[model samples]
Target: MILLDEAARHLKASLKDMDTVVLTPRLSQVYAGINGHADLLVHKLDDSTLAVAAECTDFFKNLGLHYNVMPIEGIASPYPGHVQLNIAVFGKWVIHNMKVTPEPVRAFYERQGYHFIHVAQGYTKCNLVVGRRSLITSDVGIYRTLKDIAPILLVESEHVALKGFNYGFLGGASGLINDTLVFAGSLERHPSYARIVKFLDRQGESWTQLQGPLVDVGTLIQI
Candidate 1:
């Protein structure tokens, strides 16, 4: 099953063939628009385990996936507080601002023998787009931090839409479905369209460009 934000309902037609769950504004702690962002509400620790927020436990109960309900009430609206589960996992390493990460989430990853890569950015998952063997980001801190460890693609963050922010991120606008990268909006509207395509081509990756301007509806989380 795939989890998507309720705000992204317009893209449902394109993805009608797949089973998807739309996240509604149930958590009051964070901004309403972002209440259902999977990266903020749940973290897929591994193939079987998921670290989910307390408020969202009911949503995944019938999904037949093993999940741990976090101790916190919900994700707070403030910067670091809202990013508790917003970590990016690439292969064996997980990246995030370690200082603000929830203790339980951190401990779970550590127990799984995963290495933690620290970055200054709290919204690591939002700012990063992970491929099978490579990574992409617009945040310089994240790019600089992972450049040495992996093949990282640096792109401009302009033109991506977010309800309450200046701009959304590339990671939030796209998700990987098997080997095909699915984008919520058109890639041609972005300044780095050509570069992005070339980078994907080099990695032997194909992409599906949905119609409309790019908007960050968190990420399309497949469970």
Candidate 2:
């Protein structure tokens, strides 16, 4: 609770009553700042940087959150079971679930993608909600922030804040936040997007790192 508490220390607003909030994929990193506003926020925590993960390992714990290995475990029933979606795409971070790690992936393009979406550049789009709305977003960090900000406000507002405002909102990026927050666009662009959703739903398991109102991580794996 420390991380959540500290993040909420400066803001006096009741998270449950928030109307809306804008979040970026950078919300995944600990250094990225998150506002206690918005009734709902989608977020991320599935950083692929082993070095950064080691450095920021305790960051989430310090905030009262913990990170786990979420092992890929082996292939399950469907083999392609949970689609392996990435939040990075075409060397940019517009947000998509269709992209994969890419075979023989290009270094320059990938780097550009991160740069465009990284928190420092300010181009991440994802979050979470937990007050009163059904709580929907495409990012994991934002989702966590929503969890942190919730309980401080009313529940009514949080319930419907994310009902059905998301549609035709897909760009490019298979990263966790993008996969979780994506509404619709073209699974063809990133088949992994649909695959992941299918896999998660089939497995009946959900993770805080990739749960959005429109797209649930559980469904990603299940579908």
Candidate 3:
């Protein structure tokens, strides 16, 4: 199953063969365009477990995946509140502002012995595009923080669109489905398109660019 933003419903035709769960603006606190972002609403604890917001539990209940409803009141529209579940989980390192992350999510990863990298940026997952062998991001703080620890590509943030915001993020616009990287829209319009293609080539990854200009529909959560 894959979780996608309802705003990108037009792309469903391109992904007609896949089982998709479209996230609508059910949560009042988050803005309309971002309310359905899987990175902000869902946390994958393990292969069979997922930590999700209370309002989203019903969506995953029948999918055969065990889910833990976050033990908090609804997410608020403030900076940290909306980012509670937006943690970036890499192979061995999990990056986010641990102080704001929900306890249930943190405890599970801690018990698994994963290294936690704390950054001032709360929306770590939205700012990151996790590839098989490397990482790509537009947030300078994230790039500097993980540069020494991982193979990372820092690209310009220009041209990525997000409604009601100055710009969107690369991570929010794309996701990796095994060896194939899936993008919400076209990368050819991006300023650093060539650099991004080169980075993907180096990682030995293929990609699927859907349609229209690149927009942040949040990371496509594939399970």
Candidate 4:
């Protein structure tokens, strides 16, 4: 079965074997108040322990994911919810490259055995991994850092959606399932559409687009 968040519910029937989860509206409101993005409130730390806002505790439990409630330390809290816990786990390292990250979150990945790579882009999930050592991102800083390390296709960020914001992140706009990279919307309108298709083709990965506007739904993890 495919696991998706409520924002993607419109694609449910089309996506075979679908299972969906929705975070409480209160959490959505809080996220909007901060970064205007829900991804800032959720993270799949690993197979277990899906880190999410406290309000989603029961929702995740019902989905059978071991929920780790992220404490809301207010907007000015030490941690920048927009980037602090929003890390990308790929290749050899958990690529965050941010100057500061919560120690507890950092420690969690350390125990998982991934070294942290310094990249200026805090929105790691926006850089979707098409294969084992390949990714697609619109973040130039991340592209420059991992270019020599992996096959990364740098794209423009104009078409992605962030709702109240100007644009959303690419990594957060799509997810990798068993053999296909699923995008929340079609890529025909993206400037990098052709390049993205070519990159995915070279990586031996297929992609599917759901019908709708391309919105960032956070990273979908298999629980």
Backbone clash pairs for candidate 1 read none
Worst 10 residues of 3 by lDDT: 65-74
RMSD of each: 1.8, 17.1, 1.9, 3.4
Model 3 off-target regions past 4 Å? 18-21, 64-74
lDDT per residue (tens digit) for residues 1-223 in model 3: 6677787777777665655555544566777768877887787877767777777677667566555444444666777888888888889898998889888777888899999999888889888988777888988999999999988899997578988788888898888765567888999988889999998888777787878989888787777
Report the C-alpha lDDT of model 1 over 73-115, residue by residue, as the tens digit. 5478867778888889988898999998778888888888999
Kindly provide the TM-score of model 2 when superposed on the true structure, using C-alpha atoms: 0.21
Clash pairs for candidate 4? 97-118, 97-119, 126-171
Q: Model 2, stretches more than 4 Å misplaced?
A: 1-8, 12-53, 61-66, 69-122, 126-223
Query: Judged by lDDT against the true structure, how good is candidate 1?
Result: 0.80
Give the lowest summed-lDDT range of ten residues in model 2: 214-223
Ranking of predictions according to lDDT = 1, 3, 4, 2
Clashes of each: 0, 68, 0, 3
Task: Give lDDT tens digits, candidate 2, residues 1-223.
Answer: 1112223222213211222212212223222222211111112323322111222334423433344422222211121211222222221332333232222223324554442222111212222221121233444443343444322111111111212333212211112222332222223333344544454455442323212222211111101
Give me candidate 3's TM-score against the actual structure.
Answer: 0.92
